[model samples]
Target: MTSSNTTDTATARREDPPTTAKKKRSRELIIAQLIGQVALLLAIPVLTRLLSPAEMGIYQTGLSVALILQPLATLRRELLIPFAGVRDARKHRWIGLGFAATLSGAIALVALPAWALGNATLAETLLATALILPSFALMYVENAFLIRHSAQGRLAVRNLVGGVLSAGLQVVAALILPGAIAIAAALLLGRAAATFVTVARRTPSSDVESPGEKKSQRSISAILSAMIAAASSQAVVIVSFASLGPSAAAQVAVGQRVAGAPASLIGQALTQIALSSAAPLIREQRPGMTSQLRSLTIRTGAAAAVTAAALMIGGPLLAVPILGPGWEVAGVMTAVFAVPLSLTLVALPATTLLIPLGRERLLVSLQTVRLVAIVAAIVVSSALTQDVFTTSIVTAAVWTLAYVPLMTAAFTATVAHDRLCAQVVNQSSAP
Candidate 1:
C-alpha cells in the first residue's frame, strides 16, 4: 500500500505541468483583465477629483497624440511576430529595434528643444511623449517575446504592474505636481518602470527563438504595413481632438475608457490567447484552425456586445457618482462610445488572421480606409452638428457598420486562400 501510494503521488506530480498550463494561463489572463478594469474604476474618482475636467481633457488629448506616434517610433513591433519563433530573425530584429528606439528617442529629444525655441504648439507634452520612446519601444519588443513563448503569466504581470504603477504615479504626481504635467510625467515613468519589469522577469530575448520554426525576415513593406496598422489604433482620438477641441476630445476619450471597460476586458484577454494560437495556424496553413477561429470570433464578439449593452445602461448611471459632477458630459458619452467598442471587438480576431495569412498589406489597406472614414465622419459631423457627442454618435455608427463586414470578409478570404495554397503545395510536393 505504501509503494502504491508513492507511485500514485509521483504520477500526479509528473502529469501536472502539461495538464495545467492552459488553465493556469487562462486564470492569469482573467486576473490581469480584472486588475486592469478595477484599477481604471478606482482611478476615476481620484483623478477626476484632483484634476479638473479640462486638465483631464488636455492630458488625454496630448497623450493621444503620443499614442499615435508610438507605433511609428517602434517600426511597428507587430511586424516582429512571424520571426518571434525564429533565432536569426529575432536577433537581427532586436538589434534593428534597439537602433530604431535610440535614434527615435534622440530625434524626439532634440526636436523638443527646437520646438520650445520655435515656440511650437504643445511642445511640453510632445517633449514628455518623446522621452518615453525608448522604454515604450522595449515594452513592445518584450511583448513579442512573451507572445512567442506563450508567457501569459509574465504578460499578465507586465500589464498589472505597468498599469497600476502608472495610475498610482498619476495620483501621486497630481498631489505633488500641478496641471497635466503630473499625468504626463506619470505616463513616462509608468512606461519606463513597466519596460524594466518586463525585461527583468523575462526569459532572455535570445530564448524567444526556437530552432525548429521557419524564419521570417522583416521587410520594408511589412514594416510599413505594420506602422500603418499601429497608427490606425488611435486615429479616432486624433481626429476627435482635431475636429472637436480639447474638451470634446476629453469627454470622448474618457467615455471610451470608462464605458468601454467590459469590452476592453474581454478583448484584451481574447487578444492575448488569439494571437498565440493564430500565429501557428496561419504559418502552417492549417485549414482546421479557421473553423475554431471563426467560432471564437463569433462568441467573443457576441459576448462583448452583450456585455457592453448591459454596461451602457449601468455606465451612465455610475459616471456622475464615480467621477464627480464635472464628468456628467462624459457619462452621457461613455455608453455612447462603448457601443462602438463592442463593435470593434470583432477586429481582434479578424486581425489575428492577418499575421498567419501574411496578409498585412490587406490589413493595412483596410485600416487606412477605416481611418479615412473616421476622420471624414468626424470632420463632417463636427461641421454639421458642431457638437462633440453628436459627432461621436456618427463616428461610432460608421465604425461599427463599416468595420465589421469588411473585417470579417477579409479574415474569411485570407484563411481560405492560405488553406487552398497549402493544399496545392502539399499535392505538388507529395511523392
Candidate 2:
C-alpha cells in the first residue's frame, strides 16, 4: 500500500508540470486579451466624441465587409495549420497570402466601377477593405501557426501589440484625418505592423514533419462554412447599413462592440487553447475527450449566462457613459444584444471542437441556417417597422432562437463523432 501510494504521488508530481504550464499559458493569453479589450473599450468614448454617428457607421460597415471577405481570402486554410505537419503549415501560410492578394486585387477592380459611378463612399470602403485584406490574412495564418506550436507567450505579445496599435492608430486618425476612410486606413496599418512583428520572430524547430499528415479534403467545406459564418455574424451590420441607413447601423455596431466584449474576451481566450489542446486528443482518439468538451461547453455557458444577465441589467446605464452623449440608443441596443451574444459565447466550444472533429459539412449547414434566419429577420423587421430599435429587438430575438439549434446540432455531432471514433478504436484493438 505504501509503495502504491508513493507511485501515485510520483505520477501526480510528474503530471503537475504540464497541467501547471497549461494554466500559466491560459492565464497569460487571457490577460493579454483583457488588456487588448480594455484598450479598445477605453478608445470608444474618444472615438464617439470625435467621429459622428454616420462616420462611425460607415467605418463599421467597411469593417463588416472586410470581415466577411476574410474567410474567403484565406480559404480557411489557417484552420488546417494546427492539425498539419510543419511543412504543410508553411505551405498553407504562403498559399493563404497568395489568396489574399488575389482577392484584394479583385476588390480593387470592383471598387473602380464604384468610383466611376460616383459612389465615393462605396469606392473608399472597398479600396480600404482591399488594402487591409492581405494584412488580416497574414495575421490570421501566423496566429494559427503560433497555436500549432503552443507559442502562447508569443501569441499573448501579439495580441497586446495588436490591440494597442489598433486602438492608438484609430484615435490618432480620428484626431488628424477625421473620416471613415482614415479610420479604416489606421486599422490596416496597425494590423500590418502587428503582423510584421509577429512574423519577424523565429519559431522553434521542434515540430516534426510527419508523413501520416495528409491534406484534408474538407478544406472546401471549411472555407465555405467560414465564409458563411463570417457573413452571418456580420449580417446585422450589413443589413442595417443597407436598409436602415448609417446612423442606425452605427448604433448597432457600437452596441455590439460594447455588449459583445465579455463573450469576445472569453471566446478568444479559450479558442486557441481549445484548438491546441483538443487537436492531439481527437487525433489520437483519446478517452475522456467527449467529457472534456462537454465540461468546457457547460462552464462557458454558465459564465456567459451570468455575464449576459449582468449586461442586460447594467449595460444601458453604462453605455451612455462609455460611448459618450448622443449615443443613448447605442446603450439600449447593448442591452438588447446581450442575449444573442451570450448564446454565441456558449456555442464557442462546440464550434471549436467541430474543426478537429472533421465536421465541416455540419458547420456549413448550421451557418447557412443562421444566415437565412438572421437575414429574414432583418428584412422583415425593416419592411414592417423601419425603426432601428424595433429592428434590433427582432433581429436579436431571431438570432437567439437560431443559436438553440446550432448549439444542439454541434454538441450532438461532437458526441456522435466521439462514439464512432471509440468504436473504430475498439474494433481495431479486438482483432
Candidate 3:
C-alpha cells in the first residue's frame, strides 16, 4: 500500500505542472505591465494639472521626437525576435551590429542638418533621447530572450520594477520639482534602470553573438523591410502633428495612448507568448493554431472597441476631477479619440502575424500606404483650413478607414499560408 501510494504521487508529479503556475505568471505580467502603463497615464494628468500647457506641449513635443528617433536606432532588429530562433547566431549578431551602428550614425548625421534647419531644441532633445535608443533596443532584445526562454515571470518582474519605480519617481518629481524637464528626466532614468536590470538577468547563450558581422541575404532583406515599416509608421505621427496643430495632435495622441493602453499592454504581452509558443506550431506547420490566433484577435478587438467607446463616453466625466481643470478639453477629446483608437487591437495581431511568417515586408507596405494616406489627409486638411479639430477628425477617419480591411486580409493570408505550407510539407514527406 505504501509503495502504491508513492507510485501514484510520482505519477501525478509527471502529469504536467499545474495550470495555475502558468496562469499566475501570465497574470503577473499583465498586472505589472498595467501598473507601468498606469504610471505613465497618471504622469500626464498629474503633470498637466501642475504645469502650464506650454510646458506640457514642450514635453509632448520632446516625446514625439524621441518616438521618431528611437525606431531609427533599432532598424527593426527587435522585430526579428519571432524568427530569430530559426536563423544562425552569427547572422543574428551581424544584423544587430549593423542596426546599432546605423542607428547611431543616423542620429549623428541628423543633428547638424536639424540644427542648420533651425530646429535646435527638437534636434538636441532628439539626439539626447537617441542615446538611449541603443539601450531600448538592447532591452527589446533581452525581452525576446526572456520570451523565447518562457521566463514570463522574470519579464513581469522586470516590467513591474520599472513601471512601479518610474511611477513613484514621477509622483515625487511632480510634487517636489514640478518641472516638465524633471518629469521627463525621471521617466528616462527609470527606463534606463529597467533596461539595465533586464540585461543583467539575461545569461548569454553560446548561440548568441554580438551584433557586428557580414550580413546574410535574408537578414538584409529583413532589415530593409522593417526599416520601411518603421519609417512609415513614424512619418504618420510626425505628419499628424504637423498637419494638425500641436493641441489637436496632443489630444489625438492622448486618446491613442489611453484607449489603446489595454490592447497595447496585453496584446504586446501576448506577442511574447505567441512568439514562444508559436514556434512549435510553425515547426509543425499547424493551421489550426493560426485559426485560434485569429479568434483571439477578433475577441480582443471587440473588447478593445467596447472599451474605447466607454472611455470616450465616460472620459470627460472622469477627467474633470481626476485630471483637473485644464484637461477638461483634453479629457473630452480623449473620449472622442477612443473611437478610432479601438482599431489598434485588431491591428496588433495582424501586424505581428507577419513576423513569424517571414513576411514583414507586407507589414511595411501596409504601413507605407497608411503613411501616404496620413500625409495626404494632412495636406488636404491644411489646405482647407488650419482648424485643429477638423484636421483631427479627418486624420482619425483616415486611420480607422485604412487599417481595417488591410489588417483583416493580412491575418487571413497568414492563416492560409500556414495551412498551405503544412499541406505541402506533409505531402512531400508522405511514404
Best by lDDT: 2
Instruction: Tell me which of candidates 2 and 3 scores higher on lDDT.
Output: 2
State which candidate has the highest TM-score: 2
Go through the candidates in order and give each one's C-alpha lDDT: 0.65, 0.78, 0.61
**lDDT of each residue in 196-272, candidate 1, tens digit only:** 66653435754554543546533444455545544444555556666656566666678777765665555656666
Residue clash pairs of candidate 2: none
Model 3 agreement with the true structure over 102-179: per-residue lDDT tens digits: 775576577678889998555554554455455455546656656645567778877777766776777777788765
Which residue window of length 10 is worst by lDDT in model 1? 211-220
Q: Which segments of candidate 2 are over 4 A away from where they belong?
A: 1-7, 200-204, 211-214, 427-431
| Candidate 1 TM-score to native | 0.81
Candidate 2: 10-residue stretch with minimal lDDT: 205-214
- TM value for model 2: 0.92
List residue ranges in candidate 3 displaced over 4 A: 1-24, 85-120, 131-135, 174-181, 200-252, 283-287
The order of the candidates by TM-score, greatest first, is: 2, 1, 3
Candidate 2 lDDT for residue 75: 81
RMSD of 2: 2.4
What CA RMSD would candidate 3 show?
A: 5.3
